[model samples]
Target: MWEKNGIKKNKAQNYKCTDCKKQFQHEYLYWGADINIKRQIIKMLVHGSGVTDIAKVLSVSKGCVIRTLVKTGTQVNLKSSKKYYHKVQIDELHSFVGKKEKKVWTVRRAIIYAYDAETDEIIAVTAGKRSKKQVKDLFKRLNDLTIDWFCTDNWKAFKEVLPYERHLIGKQFTKTIEGVNTSLRNSCKRLNRRTTARAAPKFLKESL
Candidate 1:
């Protein structure tokens, strides 16, 4: 059944099974570098290797790595019954596109901060461009029915966009959203790099 290259080879002779009396020919099936390659890819991802880096090192396409990771990663339910965070902090930050070329414009970014009141655990983060319309859209998407206290800085945009549930504006209250920014920067090295934003936006969104 084994070949010189360690692959299974097709058998030349046919044989009959004793119990079933079925005639069949033995064939050799092979498992080659593909399995080993997948294992290596998973290992590199565990070691904090970026998808592009893994693709480059493995000489495989980025799509392959992404598909494998997505297939293997845990999937969570999107629908949430809980509406409105007890203490939600909201803020925006700028991420640039070009560096070496002098004419670089900043991307106004927004993030929704949700934390569990009792556990103080960060629950969710929604990021997008900064705009009053966008902020309002985010709140609509959140579908939070019960927000106890929504905190932000003196950003008129938030004031214009957010609903009248319970909003607070003051200095030092936007720290939670700032902390989310810090987490995003630390976790995604690609965002911190001074390169053009060439990576696929879909993949970047998924990675986030």
Candidate 2:
């Protein structure tokens, strides 16, 4: 199935017959078209690499990096398992896009999710205000699954939404979810409000 096609005008080697007579290239003059590069992009995003950092490291353009992030983004799910988790941790990570006309801007942009403690897999996620609605919506995603109990910090939304008997409200049980928050904060530049705000005063101002 390996049939060689002549090099393109860009001087990149071309091949065919591997994908139903479709023209293919082992290497493309066009940057960021490689499967390996895309995989590395995902890996770097998970490991706390910013867009510019990924673009520089992978020798791709920033636009390509941003596009990859928008299309594939990052998957927080740790493992693929069909088994239901008995103990699930729910938590939120607070971050803001930019300063608002008033305070309480961070509340407008937050991420809440459910994480399986035993399997280390993210079960469900929701973005926006960390309110009862968002928390309820996050739980809705796992409605088909069997969840014995939930663990969360002293968030009023949890108290309102979750069953009192099936919920464990404490810092200890929520450690895993909290760790996820930290990792996301470290990985995603959008979550590092203070760092980006402080570091890029000029850029931030210009954007605003």
Candidate 3:
């Protein structure tokens, strides 16, 4: 049994467990400090709620949401449900980070995504300069998959690394992956066009 101990500093009534002598309050003074807020943050993130939107809805600060996202990201590990991929589509999206991240007027980062064309599921993702090296790192993550074909745009970078016979060029081969762009932009505020929200450099990969 828990008995009333005293009034907490937040004015909420505090209680003490008789067996363990542990103390707790039914309500918290800081909303973000609650464990449930972390769960709600993830729930809002998947349900098309942005940082600002979640802050308002949960009465927490934007910093709290970002911190929770970073922490939650570390705990998540998504493994491939399948072993082989016959066809895959590769794409890059242009996104921005605040000037604080680079000390420039604005920095544009290319987020590369590799999708299994057969199932329309993401295989790997990387973010940084749109160079051959970036694509190389993205491919490294998919090295375990027995990929038979890769479909990408006429971007010169991919040609330098991927084999010629296994590569398919042009947007026509990327129909399934193209549809994902719309869904991502619709659900993520940072990816939405004409948005003021900018992510920090470290969060680029975690947010994806």
Q: Could you estimate the TM-score for every candidate?
A: 0.48, 0.55, 0.62
TM-score attained by model 1? 0.48
lDDT on C-alpha atoms for all candidate structures: 0.58, 0.75, 0.77
Best by lDDT: 3
lDDT of 2 by residue, 107-150 (tens): 24567778886777787877666579988887777777888899
Best by TM-score: 3
Q: How many backbone clashes does candidate 3 have?
A: 0
**Candidate 1 has which clashing residue pairs, if any?**
83-144, 83-145, 84-144
The alpha-carbon lDDT assigned to residue 60 of candidate 1 equals 84
Q: Which residue pairs in candidate 3 collide?
A: none
32-100 per-residue lDDT for model 3 (tens digits): 977688888999887877778889879999889978866664455446668888888998865344543
lDDT of 3 at 89: 93
